[model samples]
Target chain A: MKDKQNLTGNLGALVKNFSNLHSIEPDSMLDLNTTTFLQKLVSKDVIDAGVRVKPKDYLKSLVLLEYFSGIIEGDYMACKNLAKISEKIRKIEDEEDTSVDPHERDSYLTLPVVIAEAALCANEKEDTYSDNASLKKIKVRYQNHDMKIDLHSPKSKKPEPYYDMIGQMVLDVTSKSVEHYLEKVSSRAELSSLIFTGHALDMIKSDSQKSKVKTALEKKDYFSASLEALKGIMKDITISVIDEYISNLEG
Target chain B: MGKKVVQGGELLFKEDIIIDEEAVRMQLTIPSRIPIFSIDEMQVFYNSHVFTLTKNSSKDAMIKVYTTEYGLNEEKSPKLQEDEYFKANTAEVNKLKEEFIKKAVIGMPDNCYDKSLEKQACLTLVEKINHAYDIAEHSYKAPPSKGLVPKLSDDSIFNTYIGDFERAMLLDGKVYRLETIQEYLSMFQKAIEPKFYKELEKKSVLMTPEEAFKELTDNRHKIHPWGFPFIRNKIWYNEKSFKIFLDGIYWIPKFASTSKNAEEKYRNAIERKIKTDAAEEGFGK
Candidate 1:
């Protein structure tokens, strides 16, 4: 019990440090071995003290902790899904080319993608041992490595006690999405067309309206004139475009 | 015949005398050897019917009398009929009345009755009234001129009221010289007007719509609706004006840059460049 308590305290401190660093750059690099360290801590004998906690909670917390720490690649399927989306955005921006010097464009694109992906995976499934098998399968696919994930393996006999952890994961991902969007566009006009379009789309109630708003946004009419139109349609909506997009992906 | 009885209007023993008391009556004849006295002595003799003669051998005899009448009488005494006392007393009373009228003419001067001067006059009037009461108890009278009197109808009216002394001295109309009671009232009215007008003007200006709007804008965050309704509705539509307004809103530090980090970087670079240039020019030394 004492060991688990110490581990929880350590996790909290790590989360705080990660947030502080994340604020400096939305996609700042983090230590790669963070998951290994977390795994080791959870393996302590005092982990039995966490028996009352559902496995879903524990898995959720682990996923959320990894997301906030900027440790996107992990054994969990949710973490892997988030990483895949981040990779796609980085690939589009050509962030991994060592020959290319670091630039604002890469950071801007990668940060939003990572945030969106994390939020989506976090929102999808609740934690269960059966879910982990599917999760491991997704994670293996995400790695693009030779290791195979066996979904048909015998399920664990006892119910895990970490469902609360999954809930935390969703919260963390949502927060990251907001933080990243704010980092990119502190000013209203600095918002990208994709984000703006997403927001405008969210405002639409019907398919026709969605198409119309999308068309208006694409033509850059949204910046020049469509803000009032958008306001009229969605007077009560408070979420920003990027946030809405991330939330949709998560949902 | 021990001594002769003399009367104010008669020579010694010359006049026929009659005496009567209760039921008795008597008459006597007079000797006319003595000369008739002067008119005054005769008047005295008539006034006092009883007179006494003091003997200094017969050659130096003197007569004296007591009289009830002191001034002109219609009958018996001809010399006392003149109206000198009446004329003298009336003249003295008239001279005193004229002096009282002269003292009542205190007031502010013509040039001193302007807007600013009116306030000063009010204060001065109050002080003078106080002083007047302290010195003269009964004789002090306030000025009668309406213009000179400070207007106490409304708060601002008293601002125009001039001092009582100035009114008494300078005002052309009837001087209602400030007496004890009126002086105190003038002082109070004068003192209260300026303060009242100041407060009234302040309230009027503050209550104006422009002032209220300014106050609203100052504490706007507290009262601002969820959204900037004015900007969203009225100001946002007009292209040219909206652009200017957006520029104004977006130009603030929080929203100007794509990110707060970018602004900090830009500022740092600018500062560094300025420092480098200064060093090159030997200005830093």
Candidate 2:
């Protein structure tokens, strides 16, 4: 019982601190949803005494487990076909690596929580989209279609840039070319436009943006990086627009 | 946050956690600009490897118990147990790590020998999972496309096996040579008013294929406290991301928009495997 109390206290503190830092209400953030597994662990007598977590309130259990295991750990089934999340913590006894950045490490330990929490809270009902005031959104809302891209890349900055990249055409609509025999070609991946840190292209320049990329990734701020990457993605339009840009130079 | 500790298939989420629709759509958007879910796939990958690692370690523990109880290997030691003597020596094996039971109890009743065995297996999984920190992977992706995402068809099939995304690697550069692209973009080549080639000629050309290829291939992204082991999604969760990645690399090269082709093939393979398994089951019975 004492352990459970400490567990609950520690959990409440962690959730409260996380909520404050992210500006999300504790209720809105990840719920320590322990409806299923812990129910099996705690007997019926405990449940009748009003200790049940209602539903999805695994917060205390999570902390207790972590205290024992040193990370959010479980292989128990909670639902069907869902991604399970666990946060990794550094143990006091282990040797630390000198090569990796601490902040970079922070981003990873928190990625699952960040991804799941972001996904749960992201706007799901928007009809259509554009975020950058500079770019005009030509796409209209489809009750069904507008949310498709948003579901997977919840962290992407805007829908317009993706549309713009898709709008690039390097081939004549009617062509006999073998390359045209393949799919439409855009020279860059959408993420290439993000140039916050040491972007593949940016690293080639005299002033490598390595620190910026490092910082953004370390911060897990792929959304901001996506905005810059959009510019980088669009620059490839010329290379696609002029099919032989690179070969023309070399040839 | 220490060093690369977690590995593929280790990033886990509660089966019940809420996932928003925007997050779902982000990967499945009909026309994606780039690949999605390097992090997700990697987690799945690491999770699988860890499961294997855990299972093997647990089994190894069982083997250790077997060896300790029987004292078989050393010259002139007790001989290997007969097939019928399985139950007699379990008490000896159970005590090896009995105290570990206090920490975790994954409740694998299948391990008939003891709590120690169960504790070791569960702890192995937990330790490996917790050990994962600050992980990321940089997946080299094929170029993006427009209007190429097959118009929503009832027929397009998405495959989620771990190998599916990598099946069609980046387009063979030799195949999409300059002439082929020029032929495809003949209009751009012929545009007199825009003079695409003249403008193209002016931009600082950046073709260092060998360098770019090596650099891009050498580059990768990672997720969480470990390296993602696979680039594919073995479980059902993020089919959309792997589907998009697969399509951009393979389907486009075949000059095909989306089709139910992969779905059909995958379903057929499963069907065959089931039939084969049923026959084997009959044999066992």
Worst 10 residues of 2 chain B by lDDT: B44-53
Query: How high is each candidate's TM-score?
Result: 0.15, 0.16
lDDT of 2 by residue, B137-234 (tens): 22323233333233221111112222233222111010111111122223223322234344332321332212222222222222222221111111
C-alpha lDDT of residue B216 in model 1: 29
Q: Model 2 in CAPRI terms: which quality? A: incorrect
Model 2 residue B222 lDDT score = 21
lDDT for model 2: 0.22
Chain B superposition TM-score per model: 0.12, 0.19
Query: What fnat does each of the candidate structures reach?
Result: 0.00, 0.00
Q: After superposition, which runs of candidate 2 have C-alpha atoms over 4 Å from their true positions? A: A1-251, B1-256, B280-284
Give a tens-digit lDDT track for model 2, residues A37-92: 12212222222222112112222222222111111111112111111221213332
